[model samples]
Each structure stands twice: as C-alpha cells, then as structure tokens.
Target: MDTLNCIECFVRSAEAGSFAAAARRLGLTPAAVGKNVARLEAGLQVRLFQRSTRSLSLTEAGEHFLREAGGGLDILQVAMANLASRQGQPAGVLKVSMGVAFGRLYILPLLKEFLARYPDVQPDWRFDNRPVDLIAEGYDAAIGGGFELPPGVVARALAPAHRVLLASPNYLAARGVPQKPEDLSGHDGILIRSPQTGRIRSAMLRSGDGRETPLDLRARILLDDPEAACDVALMDFGIILVAMPHALPYLADGRLIRVLPDWYVDTGVISIHFAAQKQLPQKTRLFIDFVVEQFRLQGLDRRFSAR
Candidate 1:
C-alpha cells in the first residue's frame, strides 16, 4: 500500500466529505478512493469516517487526524512542486480559473507570448464567472474580482472593477437620452444579476465630487451575464450597467457611450489569486509575473478605471 497516496485520498475525502467528491478532484475512481481510505483506516487501526449511502461524515478521530495532517500534506505538495520547478524546465500543467468575458477580452491575448516564453508549461485554463475553491479544485491560479480570500490563498490587485452605464446612439436618440439618474426611470433598463449572489445587482452611483445617488431604474430586461447585457445594449435594446473591461471595446469603437460619465459603480478591485506558499512552482510564479508585467505595460490599470 502506498502510504502517501492513501494519505492524499484521506485528506481530500475529509475535506470534500465524500470519496466521490475527492475522486473527482483527484482524477480517480470513487471505488479507488474508497479503497485507499479503507486501507488507511486499516493501517491506522481507526475508523475515520461515518459512511452511509447518502452521506459521508468524519469521525471525531478523523477530524483530529485532519487537523494534524492537512497542513503537513500541503507542505509536502508544495515542496514536491518546488522541487519539480528547480529541476531544469518547469514542465507541468498550469491550471487556472478566470471569468469568461474578462479572460477573453484581456488575458487570452497574452497566451501566445506566454507560450513562446515557457513552451514547457501547458495551460489548462477554465473560464467561468463563479468563484472557485482553488485548493479543492486544484487550480494553480485564478484571475477575477471579489473572491473571498480562503486559507492558503492570496490575491494580488490587478485593476479596479468599475461598472458604467452605457447606451447606443440609436437607443439614446429614440429614448430621448437620460440627463440624470432620475430620468432613467422611464427608459428601458438592462439590469444584470450578480453571479456570486444570484440576486439582481443594485448599486449607488458615485461621482468624482463625493455625491452619491441610487441607480433607480424600472427594469425592462434582466440578464445574468454581463456580455449578454453588453450585446443587448449594442443592438439598441436599452442601456446597461457593465464592468469597464466588458464595455471598453464598444466604447472605443463608438458602438456605445457612457450614459452617466461622471458617475460609476465601484465593485472593488480585480485580482489574480494563487496559493500563498513561500516557494511557488516556477511555472506559476513566471505566469503571475508575466501577467502583472503585461498589465503594467499596457496601462490596463488606468484603462480599466472608470473614474
């Protein structure tokens, strides 16, 4: 029996609460994961979990064992990753998570140069809007906004996640253009539902002079994705509030213009998240540096700001 493999299965199952869940994360069959855990329990002479057909829960001994072993397992994995990094080329899969629209608009363009520089590092990137469990999900890095900082994870600020109200010229002409937030009441409003909270986003717009006002609008259409909202606005459907990154292309080409130029929504800063380890894998470190440097060179920090 491989003690290390059994420990890994045990740790992942303990964290995930099911052998099936751990198997999904570890790329193993559920039976294999269960067998490994069983072997570990036999070797340790202690039952680790209370297993049923519908649920899996840790025994008191299992909780104690997890508390003692989880940190050491993380250290071991980090050390192994760093060892691989130090030996010649950093050759491995670099799994990362990011927003679909944001990643395509901004980060995807840098992939060619990134591959040119580090051909050995294979990029396995997942583009989605929802927050991910970086550790359990086995992501080397993630890039998005408003992720809660979990233990063993840290975030580096990338840019301000600023949302601005936008409209097409044709729509503004037909709707007679909203001169103030109060005028927005009559116009068709394209409101976005928050991906994180599953609720319609409501905000108070603030101007440069410290004045604030609620963005009171009678919603005509509600969409979950910002990209969809932007498309709807482009088709002269209505005015939509969207992040600056998603809205910038249309604004640049004159397909859309900011409705309230002085007022904007500050959702917080966009960031790149990764494991907070002293010795990160060389590929992960290199990728993070390349992205940050590119953002700096392109002045994206300034461009993404709505203020």
Candidate 2:
C-alpha cells in the first residue's frame, strides 16, 4: 500500500466521521476505505479510530496525528491541483457556506458573473445562520460573521458586523424615536433570542465618542432568527437591532430608519474563512480572491463599525 494513500484515507475518514462517507468522497468502497485505514493503523502500530455500529470517533492518537498530518495531506492535494491548474483552467466542485440573508442579498447576485468567468467551476453553496466546523464538514470555504478560526483555518474580513437599531418610519412616528440607548427601554424592542440557549442577547451600545451603554433588551416579540425579527420590525411592531447590511436597503428607500445612528453595537467583523494550508486548490483560492475584489468594487467591504 502506498503510505501516502493510506494517510489520505486516514485523514478523510477522520474528517468524514465514517469510512462510508470517506469512501464516497474518495470513490472507493467502504470496505476498501476501512482496509486502507486499517493498513495505516498497522503501519503506525496505533489505533486511530474508536468505531462502533452507531458512531465513529478519533482516538487520542488519531487526534494528535490529524493535527500533524492533515495539513501535509491537504498540501499534497493542493500540489496536485496546482499541477492541474497549470493548464490555466480551474475546474472542480467548490463548496461554500454563508449566512442566508447575506447570501441572498449579496453573494447570490454575484454568481452569474463568477460562473461566467470560471465556467469550468461548479459551485455548491449552503446558506444557513449557524457556526460550521470547516474541516469536519468538508467545506471548501465559508462566509459569515465571527466564526471561530480553529487550527488550519484563516479568515479575510469583508465588513463590520455592526448592529444598528431599526424601525419602520410608522413605528418611530407612533412610538417616538429613542434619543439615547436608555430610551430603548421605554420603547418596544423586537429582540433576537439565542437559538442554542433561548436567552435574549444583551449588548453594549457604543457611541461615536467612545461611550458604552449596556442594553438589556426588553423583548416585545422574541425570536431566534434575525430575518424574522426584522420582518416584525418592518410591520411597525417595534424597534429591532440588526446587522447594518440588512438595514441598508430599507433605510435607503425609507421603509426603515436607523435610531441613534451614531450609536451601534459592535458585534465583530463579517469575514470569509477557508482552510489554511501550505498550498491550496486554485479553484478555492481564485474564488476567495474574486469575492474580495467584488466586495471592494461594491463598497460592501467598508467597515461600518469604524464610522
């Protein structure tokens, strides 16, 4: 057995969490994948996986080896891809994850031009509003706000993930505008409850001159998703705190207005993340570069938090 081939099998199986899933990815039978991993274990004289009928997990040795060897294997794949890319056509299935709202409002529109330029590329994009484990899930890249960068991952910031108070003009006229963060307490607040904990997230609102005010959001309508809360806010229900990008269109066209525009909650930066390795597939690399360039052209990359 080729030692590198066995290493590939070991890393893929570890990431996929099942020999069967790795087999599908590697275009091998599940038994062949199992045998390859077994050969690797035999060669190393160590058990790499704790396996059962229902679950598969990495052994302590496996975890340690993956940290060291996974990058080498990925680099090998990148080298191979680089050789193929020398022909000047980047072709492969590009897998990406992004936020639902941002993807729909922003990235989805750019696909036509992206695909037209890289006609050989096939894009598989997932739009959801949750954290993703890049390696474990086998994603090529992800675009969202403030995902933790585990080892083997890096990020390029796209924009400030600033949250602003938004309400429909009708709602503001009806309830009166909040002159300060404290006034939000007197007004109805459409709040975002955490999906994991169901707790309404409290935030510190910051003013332009560096004043911070703690906001204990009083939820008139508590929801787990930002889109839903924004919808409620649009209906003149209450003031909603949302990502600045989400409120941009509404604020521009007069559907919604920003309250205390000088004050915002600095969540973090919205960024695109990818696996960091010595070498990378041309398809993934080119896609990341292109997205950043497009953001620059569109002025979407502006750091609203700074303003």
The model with the greatest TM-score is 1
TM-score of each: 0.94, 0.87
Candidate 2, residue 37: CA error in Å? 2.6
Question: How many angstroms is residue 95 displaced in model 1 relative to the true structure, after the best TM-score fit?
Answer: 0.9
Screening candidate 2 with a backbone cut-off below 3 angstroms (N, C-alpha, C), the clashing residue pairs are none
For model 1, the stretches where C-alpha displacement exceeds 4 angstroms are none
| Tens digits of lDDT, candidate 2, 92-159 | 88989988888998999999999898888889899988867777677889998844678878999888
lDDT of model number 2: 0.85
Predicted structure 1: lDDT: 0.88
lDDT by candidate, in order shown: 0.88, 0.85
Worst window of 10 by summed lDDT in candidate 1: 82-91
Weakest 10 consecutive residues of candidate 2 by summed lDDT:
298-307
Cα misplacement distance, residue 152 of candidate 1 (Å): 3.9
| lDDT over C-alpha atoms for residue 300 of model 1 | 98
